[model samples]
Target: MFARDSRLRQWLGQWLPKRPVTRRDSPATARGGQGDVDRVRRQYLESEQRFRALLESLPKVAVQGYDRDRRVIYWNEASTRLYGYSSDEAQGELLEDLIIPDAMRDGVIAAHRAWIHESVEIPAGELELRHQSGELVPVFSHHVMLNEHTDEPLMFCVDVDLSDQKRAHRDLEFATRFDRLTHLPNRQTFEADLDEVLDGCRRRGLGLALLYLDIDRFVEINDALGYEEGDRLLIELSRRLSEQLRATDLMSRVSGDEFVLAFPGVHREDDVMRVLHKVQEVFRRPFGLEGHKRSITASLGICLFPDNGAGARELIRNADVAKNQAKLEGRGGLRFFHQHLHDDLVRQHRLAESLERALDNNELFLHYQPQVSAASGRIENLEALLRWEPLPGQPVSPQEFIPVAERSGLIHRLGDWVMEETCRQRAQWRDAGVKLERIDINFSGRQMGRHDVFERLEAHLRRYRLGPREIGIELTENVLIEADARILEGLHSLHHRGFRIAIDDFGTGYSSLSYLKQFPVTSLKIDRSFVRDAPGQPEDRAIMEAAVFIGHRLGLEVVAEGVENAEQLALVRDIHCDLVQGFYFYRPMPADAIERLLVGGVQSLGSLSN
Candidate 1:
């Protein structure tokens, strides 16, 4: 049996084991087999060594592995090169201790547990690692759990330095939130900070304050000087405001000449008063810019938290409403939010909405006021004035609707309609042999700023088949104050097209004489305010005389408006005014009514001198 078993073993060895195998011989054979095992072991060691060398030689990325407890077990040489640490120094280190900030350690551990238990893939995301030099290096790390036996887990991580990416993202965020001109937080940042502060206040049962501030007469300064000087002044103002604010306060530039302040922990009304007083005092000091010393004042409005509003948006709205009230009452003052202010804002909003639909609903019409020659006392031109005849049970004054139209961006369309209607009426009068010399249409400040003003005017002239010489555009001083290059270009184009330009309500704005020489103006209409008291007021007379003299010197035809009496007319004629139009001559009448008098001539109408 032993011999047979030995033979069987030997046969088995020959077939499967590849060696002679007797029970004792098998033991001897096993001893010889150790040499072959050592050779195979040596080969595996050499191959593994070559693989480790190749992995360390590659410059692709840094790699590290950690056990379930977050203890580093393996760290490649690339980890040393990328993180300023040797593999020996990093190995056996707790990953949380090496890479995670103390504040973020709990979150990192939670994420690792989730990755292990859920077998979830944690994608590449930014993390901060402490290097051998103790400096934090931002890195994009991709991590995954390796459950080799589907039991104990190991975390493998590949890290890429994201310092450049982090810096770029920070810079982009700053640029988006900060204004380059004033270097203050912009409107977007202001709104974000406001929301955060309001949320914090609500959560913590704290008080907050909001201040809406607008620079008074900023537009006038911008118009009189230039944008560069204006920007410099705003920067200086921002610096001063920054100095005045507390560390917890945030100041932001919300718009051109408007700023918003958010003050958290402002629990008392006196604190708001104190800040406003400081702002006023700081602004009262004169600012020197480009060889000019100028002083500016701000209108400020305050809205308190929990009292005026419950949230950021409502607080800002209430503050804005109060600010407008401050402007309406008088600029360079401060006001607090009141319920009545909200009512007023609601009314204004409704009115603005109604005005938006006014033109579409055919509620707008034109009233023709005769423009009689001062010398001949004959109606030669008609000035078309805008009138808002609202729907039944509603009546909107031009004073109300005109400003609304300007604010709502509807003035351009409304002005075009007025121009078309005026030209059509003029053409009708001409066809009836009324012999109208010109039809003057009023242009808003917005219309003058339109880039397509010239094109639109030309189209209207062609549409009515009227000559450019037969129409005149009357612009207020506000138009020139807008002072856009496009406006000047549009006016020049109109002049080149043979359309006459008249400065309406002249002498009411800054440097009228300077603009008269600068612009290609054909006529000057003295403002009615000056004319209303001209006969009695010596100042008014002197202003009128100076205006008339300036007009003649500049070779501009002077027209006096608001001549209510013969006495005023005598004053106008004495100043050698070229034309006159007012209630005394004739009130604004319908197109057909004006046509009848025009066809009949001066003899058919009553005396205009009155």
Candidate 2:
């Protein structure tokens, strides 16, 4: 047995015992010994074949075996498929030369030597492997050390393909960084790029320009043409803008109809202006949307690094401030960040802060402007206008604070307050035996789009014991044009609840006549622009007359806004306008003063009718 053990060890490098002759060295013992030896040999061959079959059957995983010296010993078909190498080419080749990239060969060889000599295990995880085609293939590798009794030490790597996973991850990343509509970098990626650019500019002490651009009157285009058409126009605009930008510069669509451009290193402020002028020139041509060639302009706000701000957030905020200033100054213009712009923003912030407390401090009040009937010239309806008188300061203009409220998301609470207050005042007038016609209250787009507006207003009416007919909801034309289904449902629901809907600033928006027909509107208030010059301008008079004619034909009342003189009033009345609201008949007055006028029983407002 000892001799047999040594001989088998020499043959197979494995220790095996020789079975004793069970029949005391007879013929039976010899036959049994031969049978056992033959059985052991056959078992080894079968196990080897099974292992080979397993490697061959794996269609998606590469099974490669290498020696301690990192030379390839075995390469399966899957290995060939993955690495673009045939078994004849891969086998007996150095693993480093076969799969390891030039930069990683040394490290991989060292790791393999450590695993072989020191019994240190190679850590298994996902990594990229180089294919013969020079393409990088992602794979999750599982390593096994084969230390068979008869065979030399070997390392086997079973790699599962991770190419699909990596591709999916790349696609997800792209979707996250890009906007679906314009296929441009979205706000997140844009802001990140801005931060990176700002850091580089700061380090080099370079002048950088950040331009914030808003498409002028984009809302009108969106309302006039459908949103689908608007999307096409935006795509075309993006293409045009991209054609004008340098490859080094970054342009991103930060918001709806708003884009951001970053110039990391500029020689002078004039360079920034030159780039902006190029951008302006890009939009000089019209973009054809739905067969209509519509011309659009951009309002640009420029802020310089190291001058306006040193950081990303500060620069963006200041640029936004300058942008709003540009819009206020006039559209189709550009403005640089200035200290006064910052001061104005500070003032706006202060005003917003005051407005938050104004409602609580009872500083808010409503002034009613009577909308008189054109036929009898008597007070028919009154429009409730909001006023704010914060203590220790002059009255804040609604034009200024209202926009602030809208931006700061305070419009929701402010609008609710105004609605509730108007309702309460109307209830007071009723209790005082003063006849109150329908009081028109303005509704911002924010208010109209709210899901809870209907419920909130219903509660207010119930609280004041007022019916919906006692008041009206006035919204600008853009509100109806941009209204989603939820807002439309809300409007229709309000109309069904006996609430009157008025399209304020009619003819000022880009909505087609179809919207006027589709919406449940009770009146169209001709915008002040037409009424302001109707007495002289033929175009103005023609528009005014058309507005009135359309209103009457649609079974809706027409109210001429900004009627500040007898001549304008006479012109609107001659055009057969149903109602007139402006300073000419009665300026916006306090509730008590309006109550006096209501109680006076005057058949005419002021001396216009008399």
Candidate 3:
């Protein structure tokens, strides 16, 4: 190859000889072959100079070449521009010395050795390049094997500064997948991670567990301590949970006060129990926020891979079902997925569907229980109660159906039906010359929490052409425990519109006297549990007395329910209870029967007498 290149140069030098003469001298007359050689050499020198200037003028990009032994052969101007090193400085330096970080030197060397032996092109991958100014810049490098004869390798590295790109990517990822307040993974990320883990478990024959956790009474804490303190407490709790879990565990915030943890490779039930026990211990410690020492508890439900479910949706559903069962069993508990829970869920689903059909089928009916004035012994009002009559041979109690209705979002329909029916009945009675004072219907906590309840009530009143004063809404202490401001506003609006509000089943839950005073309550109904044993059990008597006094102190009338005997009635009368209702007065009867009793003065009930 050298001899060929030399002979070509000699022939070029002879053809283009360097001279001061121009076209004036003919080719044959010019200084023989020597003139041609000189002319060719001059032309070659000009072309070489032009090519060198063009390469230098372009942008700084490196083209490097190395042998199979990893010896540097060429370094372009771009290398100098990027690494603050000239060609002279990089000529003898090993390629590894220029691009690889000190910690990754051994790995780079091994990778290069493998590439040389395999004679394969290793495309650009991540590497750190040390600049002359001592700053390490993250870069991508490409290595290529160029020669096959002597096992020589040619490598070209194109370094791109990725610090800004990395920062922007991380920020975007955080915004998309993490909660801002607690720095925990959010629902979107949690679902994605759960799917990924479940897929892997299926492929690898591994065991996976998912724990769904919900903080008990978190709303109460938020309401009692203000939102700022609540936020602080949540942040602290998230931090504590992160600290307590293993590094391999994945924890995420799926909703308000609800979290989900994915435990990978938990082969045994004991492993799951141990992790849950540790979590319980962590939450058992009291949290001190702004001088208030408050403690919180979690109700957790667990579902395992290939046992409870195989996919993300099924696993989450089973876990949620178990969590609900834990809550139903009481707070601060844990439950595992079982066949019975699945069956119960299926039954609930069917019941919800049937309830939706019930409304359309006109199977819901109302029964009226007369409330008699204690002083006059005359029926002053009638409480409207709902009854669902399923298909033939199926009789379901309100206790069993009401909760399902509330959970399945069917309460709104149920409430609207009751309201319209109550108003229509009252209007019918007035038109028929039967004097009924008011019709009180119960409202579920879910119904009371709805924003559109006032509009619904107004619409129903207009539909029936009934006055708002003739309709009353009864709510239990559970409604107040929710303590939603929207609910309070709704109650106030109803009150302003001349609708009376009654607190049903009072003294059965955590009734705060101070908060109760602020409510626009017109009456309080003592719980039947307390009334059932009243005038006999001392505790029941004391509770009944305190309730009557509290109601009177608040300037609200008190009604005693479930008064089955004369002794109970006399005791309530002595306490100055304003109204009494129970089997002692009358069982709930159909609307026609109630009207007959109203017209006949209670003598028409001989057939239903106990």
On TM-score, the leading prediction is 1
Instruction: List candidate 1 segments past 4 Å from native.
Output: 1-74, 88-131, 134-209, 214-242, 247-259, 264-273, 280-300, 304-310, 321-344, 478-498, 511-518, 535-555, 565-576, 601-610
Q: After superposition, which runs of candidate 2 have C-alpha atoms over 4 Å from their true positions?
A: 1-46, 53-61, 67-72, 88-97, 100-130, 134-206, 216-243, 246-248, 264-270, 285-296, 327-333, 360-363, 367-385, 389-399, 406-415, 428-610
Question: Which lDDT values do the candidates have, in the order given?
Answer: 0.79, 0.83, 0.78
Count the clashes in each prediction: 0, 0, 16
Cα lDDT tens digits for candidate 2, 327-348: 8666797888898889977888
Q: Candidate 3's residue-wise lDDT over 1-610, tens digit each? A: 0011334334333432233444566667665867676776778777656644544554544445566555666666766776777888877788668755687778667767666575434446565677778788655554434443354444434455555676788999898999988989898887788888887888889998888998898897888887888788778878888887776778888788888888888859788888787788878789986697777888999998888887777888899889988987777978998978999889989988888988998888999998888766778899999998976538678997899999999999999999889989988998999988899989888887778887888888888788867889898877866757878887887877777889998888884777667887889999989988877799989989999998899888799999887778788889899998888878899999999989975542312332
- C-alpha positional error of residue 562 in candidate 1 after TM-score superposition, expressed in Å: 2.5
User: Could you tell me the lDDT of residue 229 within candidate 1?
Assistant: 84
Give the TM-score comparing model 1 with the true structure, all chains together. 0.69
User: How do the predictions measure up, each by TM-score?
Assistant: 0.69, 0.64, 0.66
Off by over 4 Å in 3: 1-88, 91-212, 216-277, 284-296, 302-322, 325-342, 374-377, 391-393, 481-498, 511-518, 535-556, 563-578, 592-603, 606-610
Q: Would you list the rank order by TM-score, best first?
A: 1, 3, 2
Task: List model 1 lDDT by residue over 326-387, tens digit each.
Answer: 88666697889998889866777788777767777988788889877787778868899888
Better of 1 and 3 by lDDT: 1
Q: Higher TM-score: candidate 1 or 3? A: 1
